[model samples]
Target: MQNKKNVTLLIIVAALGYFVDIYDLIVFNVVKKQSLQELGFTGDALKANEIFLFNLQMTGMLLGGLLWGIMGDKKGRVSVLFGSIFLYSLANILNAFVTDINQYAIMRFIAGIGLAGELGAGITLVAENMPKEKRGYGTMIIVTFGALGAVVAGMVGKTFGWQTTYIVGGGLGLTLLLMRAGAYESGMYQNLLHNSEIKRGNFFSLFKKWSLFLKYLACILIGLPIWFAIGVLINLSDRFALAHGLIEKIDIADSVMYAYLGLSVGDLASGLLSQYLKSRKKVIFVYLVLSVSLMFVYLFNTNVSVEYYKYMCFGIGFGTGYWALFVTIASEQFGTNIRSTVTNTVPNFVRGAVVPITLSFSSLSKTMGPINAAMWVGLCCLALAFLATLYIKDSFSKDLNYFEID
Candidate 1:
């Protein structure tokens, strides 16, 4: 009973940690234009700077993922959790006071570094500690609860103004730090820590073997469409609406709210369905197809009413609802020693894929226009994800109590 209590408490901490992570993650998308305009960026400068800041933040995550993932294995998941939250919480508070674009970018990059650690560390702890048969549900609860932070971001970003939104998000993270006090380390991680003979947290070792490299690459690939949709389709929906000749303007925050609302429902449904079906690949395959089909619908049609366009955003978000399952698969794929590294780096790499994705979109837009550029870029992402899904092994019933060798 006490063990179960500890597990429950750990899940609660992971869930709420992820909640703040998502809030800070999505809040920038919600307030990008308002905040940028307030800093005096107008016309093409606004669009260019938006991409710059967003990509810079993703770059921070790319680096931070490596930093925290290595630390999660070498030190412990609990320490990474505390350290990451503290760095990001302080950075977020500093974000409220930025008076120029450079300051804004610096704070965002710092906050990104801090934000990168939360989900991977939290998920690693939950996965290592939970029973194999029920870990999917555990991860599902964290992600579903966490995704709601985007909805709250939409509300708070709209109601509280951009500066207050940053303050509120940072405050929530600091408050959650108090609750992190009750969390315990993963038993698997703890056991691995005592065995100095076992190799752990070597990021370069993944590249030493062909099969290992491919598996790691496939894990990252299967998640590309998720970020592409959110990063391009939903985040830049306003520009798309203008290109489509739609009379009504799209509100960035509302689109994110509606889409994430679908994402929350989709995550819940996919989690239950994966358990019932007892296969991760099948659920992911289905969601990937649904997302791709909706992307075509979203791009091909110009007759959609503003309300209908928002519904389409919700549909696309629902279709890509395998976010938690994707991370869970990565967590289950490796040994306890390097599992945190794999889990952390895979998601952020996909997020960082947005750098190339948005860059490609921008370049292609100059020649073919934004709608067609998005369609082509999205198709490429979807195709890669589908093929990679076929290539990687299903980890649903795999044991994770082993170590990776050097």
Candidate 2:
């Protein structure tokens, strides 16, 4: 068993690592318009660039998810955690020096790759270290604190030049690495390391079994609505609000800020709710329903002001707050051998889902307009998410001292 002091330190470091990961992940969204406008994009070109860049970043995350996830199971979670932060921090600082769109796109992609490793590695570490009954609380505290990074991104993006904002985020990430020097690997992983007979970090093994493949797919689908809510409805709130006939211009940064504030609250509440209910599935179901309900309200409601739009952002964010619980379920579903791989890839794949989700929205918006387009795409995602939730087994209180077999 790990010492209480070390476990606590690990959790704190993991939480802060996630904080920086999220800040870099979301800072691009906050500064998208400003950054693009400075590069001479205007009107539709600006929107196009934003989506393109966002997708590029998500693409990087998608690829990075696989790389870092494999590395976590092979190298150690702590290595991936700090390694990812270091890569993204360096990317962010370089991002501040870009003079053209191509340079910006490249940086976003690099940063996305770097951002991919933090949460899964962090959650897996904390989850494995804590006791089964209390592990939810440990993971909950990490995500609840970490989700606030989006709020900080919004504030800093609003107050500083886009370049300065990127620099600040980079600086924060580098500073965070210093605090991580004392972090150690989980006992489960350490044990796995000693058993050379056991195959570890095998990504292809997941696809070899039909049931296991379904389990992996279910974990990925269960999280689709989260990214849709954040990546589409909130990130592009200005477009949706305008389509709904609001004359007042909405700030994307403010929308992201308020939604993340709600997300922070929601994460804390959902985490506590899951612990109290003692069932991860039940909490996920509740939040999914909330997310779907808010999606309807956000899409269909025609009458709204700036304040109402922001409130809707918060409501949607709160509804999607089951993010940490969703990731926890994925971490618990697999064994230690492939646990890090599953944990890391699941959330990033969910984040990566934004690619298809946004692409669909972009295509549909060309004809039906942004509101109805988001409605259709969001419906598809939510329906898939609900089904995925049903498909996956309840994982609360599952013992983590096992291994997947050939």
Candidate 3:
């Protein structure tokens, strides 16, 4: 008999937490010019140097995920979520002050640990608390807010200079602190009296069941590589377009913003379709094939030419399908008891660990050409998503205790 207001507030706050983490993670590349120049890496090969920086920067997501996953499973998810938000938010505030590339890299790494933690912990909070009927829809709302945050950064950069962009990020991060202050721990979490074998908040008790860990291992290994490829494409796309003189800087910003909008739109559709569809497994099977199919058009073709609409279509198919189905559903795949163990797999480490993915895209762009390198990535990994989909099972609204027992 809880009121609707508190639950609504909790969801909103959690969404903001996710949004700002993505803001900091993405804004670096969005405003790459000033930051790179500020760092003092001056030469004909300055562009080459940027490739490494971007790769190093994005790896923070992995560190954050691993950090929060264990903490959320061990400690209270709410507390871990709070810590992740504070640390990463503060990191972005500090990011505005860095005078050099080395300092930015170090801060970004620290920010990443916090950033990754917030993502895993925040998603866990929403999934654990929301009702099953709205769970998939809830995932759409949260990630959509994150995409919106990226859109905000681009809009701000277009109007204001890049330096002020971090100031805005810092302000948003700080404002989120107010929103989170009122967030009460989930009532569901507070009630553990019904269970006998399990203690209310025992860290060691989670792993007392061994089979759960085995299942997690398979999901993590298969998922991380594909996420790595996706991240590479996103980080490189704007830079690739800018380098080729294919579009104006403003148009580049608009394209990225459009991608976010398209991604969020696709998410809404995925959520709606889930209710009418019986087999989420079957839905994902189609999504995987479509994602791979579109990757062919995305990688080999140009998003800048008269073919821009085709690229936009590719985004709708791939970006939306990735989070709406792959990442979003990953959190819901396992039971709440060990949800963190499994769902956090592809989000954090899947793309997080591969520092080389971004680097490879950058190198390929430098060596061959942006579109050609993209083709290589698409052809190499297009069918991989389908292969991974083969092993996936829907974990929708699982019975927590029963999932653990099985």
Candidate 4:
């Protein structure tokens, strides 16, 4: 009974931790226009600044992903949970007070660094500690709860305004810190810590071998479409709406909220479907196809009502809901020594992929227009994701108690 209690507590705390993470991560998107306008950015300036800040934030996550992943492996998962939350929470509190774009971008970068740790550490802990048979359910709960944070962010950003939303996100992270008091470190990680014979947290080791490099690359590639969809298709909903000649401007916040709500449902459904099908690759492939199909529908059907467009956003989000399984596969693919590193970095790399994805979209937009550029980029991302999926081995039932040798 006590054992079950510990597991339950971990899951709850991890879920809330991720909840705050998502809230902070998505809040900026929700409030970008209003906040930037308040800071004197408008028209093309506002759009340019938004993209810059967003890219900077993802850059921070890319760097922080490596930092925290190594720390999680070298220091401990619990350390990451505590340290990451503190950094991000403090950054967010300061974020509420920024007077200029430079300050805003810097704070967001710091917060990105902080947000980088939550999901990887939480998933690592949950995967290591839970019964192998039920780990998928555990991770699904974390992601589903985490994804709902975007929904909450949408509502909170809409209700409280941007500054207050930042304040609330910071407060939630600090509040979640209190719960970490009861959390325990993963035994698998502990075992690795005691065995000094095994080298741990070696980021460069991933590239030392062709096979290992390919596995890591494939893991990262399979997730590019998810970020491309969110960072491009939905994040630029206003621009797309303009391009489509809509009668009404689609509310970015509502589009984000509805899409995330769909994501939550899709994560739950995909997680369950993967369990039922007993094949992570198959489920991911199916969802990737769904995602591509939805992307085409979204790009081609511009004459639809605002309400219908929002529905399409929801469908796209749902189709991209294979994220939990993607991370789970990453965790399961490696040994205990490098699992945290791989698990943490894979998703962040995917998130960071938004930088190039956005850049490519921007360049292509110059030549083909925004909607057509997005269509081309979306197709390329989907194609790469499919190819990557072909190379990834199924890890649905793989054991986690092992090590990556030097």
Candidate 5:
């Protein structure tokens, strides 16, 4: 029922969701130390707690993602996207008022729910609407805009305070709700409504399918562990940056800005990179290996000569190579009926399972040098990417039907 011109509006609304998603999450990572201290994490190694907090955020992302996936598939991606906007915005605003680490972590988990909702619904909306050849392009736009949100959060944190940053993120999330309400549902879903009976399925049937089951396993094996590290790092990076004085005294907004700028650059380049590579799996493969090696080198080479340079490289490479690339690959691997199902749920369960265990790993990293610990974790996770990449087929130039959920 919608024309190609409507596609323009789709990009704007969808990209706005992505933007808020990044804003909500990236601040935790960029200003981890300051936030932890503000909420009463004090010790010789306040930084260590960052890993646990990071786990909480990732866990939230995973859980939110799973629920959002099911809801989007059943209720319509637009409905879920709007739902995400409200949840994350309110949670962010509330996050500013929390007082203790326990409360902070709990609040973050709540916020993560909103974060999960937006990411799941927004991604599915873009993938469902875009032409097959350009799905990656649209996804890249979503990622880039979302990454830009991090930049905005970071800049705001640096200029004002983390609380102020959350206020902006909250306001942005609130403003978008009305915009999202005006958006349309999937053309595919509309067709289903007009020409077919609603064959309403329950939650259990959604996951019982063998295809979704295997994809869930893959998400656990390859996706969750790496994401565990990513979540921890994002929540804790301000401390790391300040460690070398590239950032001095964890000015929350500035640290966030540094991270956001890095991710935005990576999103743009990786989007182009994934488009040109003609093979998402292979590009992911190369970046996974390279990012690990680079993370290790960056960790030990603490020469003040290039402190900010190292932080910039780490943020950009992490965004371009490890973080955004895998999702693009996963989106195209599942068919339409189950694509949203796979994208949203698989990452969630995998993250949930991995987070607690990964917290132990983070503890070890915290005891060790943050960089050293990250390198060790990065290497292990990258190794998983290596194995998964071998099994993941290229989907860009292929027909969607060629790759079903399994």
Candidate 6:
């Protein structure tokens, strides 16, 4: 009974932690126009500054990914859970009072660093603690609940104004810190805690071997389509709507809400399908194909209604909903000594990929126009994701009670 209770507590805390993570991670995008407009940004200035802040936050995640991943493996997952939330919560609260874009950008970068640790550490812990047969469901629950945070951000941003929305996100993170106190470290990590002989948390080790490097690179590549769809297609829904010849304005918040709603459902379905088929690679492949199909549909259909475009946003989001499984695969592929590092870094690297993805999209837009550029970029991401999925070994049923060694 105590064991079950512990599992329940872990799941609850991890889910809520990720919930706050997703909320803080996306709330800025939801409130970008409103918040920036109040701070004196308008027209192209608003759009350009939004991209700048978004890239800055992602840059922080890129750096934080390496920092937290090493800490997770070297210190412990629970430490990351507590430390990341504290830093981000403080940054988020400060974000509420920022008067300038520079202040806002600085706060976001801090918050991004804090946000980078939660999902990866949480997923690593859950993957280690849960039974292998049921681990997919555990991660599915974490991700499904986490995805709804975007929906919550959308609704809350609409109702409370941007400042309060940020405050609420910060408050949620702080609250999760209390709940995190009861969560325990993984036994696998604990076993290695005193083993001074084993080299743990070595980030450079991942790149030193050709095989390990390819595996890590494949794990990162398989996730590119997801961020492209969310970071580019859905976030810029208004521009896409205009390009599609729709006279009515499409709300970016609503697009984010509906797309995340689909993402929640898709996470649940994909996780279950992975369990039933007993294969992560097959499900990812199917979803990548679905994502590609939806991307083309979204791009080629120029005369669609705003309602049709919103549904298309949902489709694209659903198609890219293999996020949890992808992270789970990363965790499963690695050993416990570096499991936290791999799990923690893989998702952030994927999130951080948004920097290059956005930069490429921006450069491509100059020659091909925004819509065509986005379509071309989407194709590239999907192609890479599909090819990478083929290269990664299937990890279902693999025992994880091991360690990475030199």
Q: Against the true structure, what is every candidate's RMSD?
A: 0.8, 1.0, 3.8, 0.9, 3.8, 1.0
Per-prediction TM-score, please?
A: 0.99, 0.99, 0.83, 0.99, 0.83, 0.98
Instruction: Candidate 6: list runs displaced more than 4 Å.
Output: none
Each prediction's total of clashing residue pairs, residues at least 3 apart in sequence or on different chains, is: 0, 0, 3, 0, 9, 0
- Give the lDDT of residue 86 in candidate 4: 92
Model 3, 241-264: lDDT tens digits are 554466644343455555666666
Using lDDT as the measure, name the better of candidate 1 and candidate 2. 2
lDDT of 2 by residue, 1-406 (tens): 4499999999999999988888999999999999888999999899889999999999999999999999999999999988999999999999999999999999999999999999999999999999999999999889888989999999999899999999999999999999999999999999999999999899999999999999999999999999999989999998888888899999999999889889989989999998898898888889888888899898988889999988999999899998889999999999999999999999999999999999999899889999889989998998998999989989889999899997
lDDT of 1 by residue, 37-130 (tens): 9999999999899899999999999999999999988888998889998888899889989999999999999998999999999999999889
What local lDDT score does residue 348 receive in model 6, on the 0 to 100 scale? 89
* Model 6 lDDT per residue over 246-330, tens place: 8998888889988998899999999999999999999998998899888888888876887897799789889999999999999
- Candidate 4: how many backbone clashes? 0
Off by over 4 Å in 4: none
lDDT of 2: 0.93
Off by over 4 Å in 5: 30-41, 44-52, 192-212, 219-229, 232-256, 309-325, 347-358, 366-372, 397-406
Error of 3 at 181 (Å): 2.5
lDDT of 3 at 104: 76
Instruction: Please report how far candidate 3 places residue 192 from its true position, in Å.
Output: 5.5
Worst 10 residues of 3 by lDDT: 197-206
